[model samples]
Target: MKIDWKNKLTSRKFISAVTGVTIAVLAIFNVDNLTTEKVTALVSAIGLLAAYIVGEGYVDANRDK
Candidate 1:
């Protein structure tokens, strides 16, 4: 079976889940709060950028249809 990776990558839930998991792993390793926060922010920013890029690509692809 094939997976729709584009849809998964653009999903808010998937992004949130990834962020949550990242934070949890950091906490498990006793990472400092400041570093954890920074990591979380970076992950969120990257996720947003990825979602925006993928969404725009999809729109552009269908614009001429």
Candidate 2:
């Protein structure tokens, strides 16, 4: 099966995935003395952001036409 990387690169999934990874990396490397509550909040925020990104893409794609 051929992988359509061009479309993948420009897709909402790609954006959200990259954003999530970036957030994880930032939290792991930049945060000092992390706690469970902080980690949970960070992950929850990322999930919400990712969902918003995907929902926005869907809305944009299906906007009045």
Candidate 3:
């Protein structure tokens, strides 16, 4: 089946997945600029993004009912 790349690119889940993967790769590289504090901040930011995604999904589901 053909996938809709444009729709996927505009999706929150897809954006999150890409962001998470990029973060993981950065952690793996142990970049000199990404210190402990920076990593902690990044984790917190990702957590907020995830929470927003879940909350938005919940709201959308409820609205559909």
Candidate 4:
């Protein structure tokens, strides 16, 4: 099956997670304290982004019957 990059980029989950990760990255990189909450948040944000990307890839790959 052919994958649609545009569709993946426009995916809700993909966009949401990537945005969250981008914010977290910005905050963590700029913040002075890397507290437990900050670390947990960063991990969650990155995890969400990864999961969405993988999900989008999977859906795209299996779009054809």
Candidate 5:
């Protein structure tokens, strides 16, 4: 019953799904195109950074093993 949140957070599929859902919600609210684009870019950047950080942490953890 436990969720592997680390894997989820680092998953490209999961990140893309989140970005899609965010865009959908923005569209539903009739957000301006510029604002939506900005939000999307920010989300994508954050997702990439998060994945990189997690991946590096995993590598560092296993480096001495």
Candidate 6:
């Protein structure tokens, strides 16, 4: 089925799903307290953002080249 990008982006369902995954990861995978993992979480999140941007940029950059 074709996906609806506009509605998906605007929906609270997306936010709630991401929140649920984050809660599960922190609660189940985090051995230490959430406080101790705050920095690690931030860094990981940033790294993922960087990777996503780089991948997307690579595609769009080449497409326009």
What is the TM-score ranking, best to worst?
Answer: 5, 1, 3, 2, 4, 6
| Ten-residue stretch with the least lDDT total in model 2 | 31-40
Report RMSD for candidate 6: 6.2
| lDDT measured at residue 22 in model 2 versus the true structure, 0 to 100 | 60
- Residue pairs with clashing backbones, model 3: none
- Output the TM-score of candidate 5: 0.92
Error of 5 at 41 (Å): 0.5
Could you tell me how far off, in angstroms, the CA of residue 61 lies in candidate 5 after the best superposition?
Answer: 0.7
Candidate 5 structure quality by residue, lDDT tens digits, 1-65:
99999999879998899899999999999999999999999998899899999999999999989
Any residue pairs clashing in model 2, and if so which? none
State which candidate, 2 or 5, has the greater lDDT: 5
On residues 1-65, what C-alpha lDDT tens digit does candidate 2 reach at each position? 99976456556667667666766776777665455346656766666676677667768989964
Winner by lDDT: 1
TM-score for each predicted model, relative to the true structure: 0.92, 0.46, 0.47, 0.45, 0.92, 0.44
User: Residue pairs in steric clash, candidate 5?
Assistant: none
Question: Which tens-of-lDDT digit does each residue in 1-65 have in candidate 6?
Answer: 99976456434556456555666666776656765467446645654565566667668989998
Clashing pairs in 1: none
For residue 56, model 1's alpha carbon misses the true position, in angstroms, by 0.4
Segments of candidate 1 deviating more than 4 angstroms: none
List candidate 6 stretches off by more than 4 Å: 1-32
**What residue runs in model 4 are displaced by over 4 Å at the alpha carbon?**
1-34
Give per-residue CA lDDT, model 4, range 1-65, as digits (tens).
99987666656667566656766776777754456457656656665676677787778989974
lDDT of each: 0.96, 0.65, 0.67, 0.67, 0.95, 0.61
Residue 7's lDDT within candidate 1 is 92
How much is 50 displaced in model 2, in angstroms? 0.1
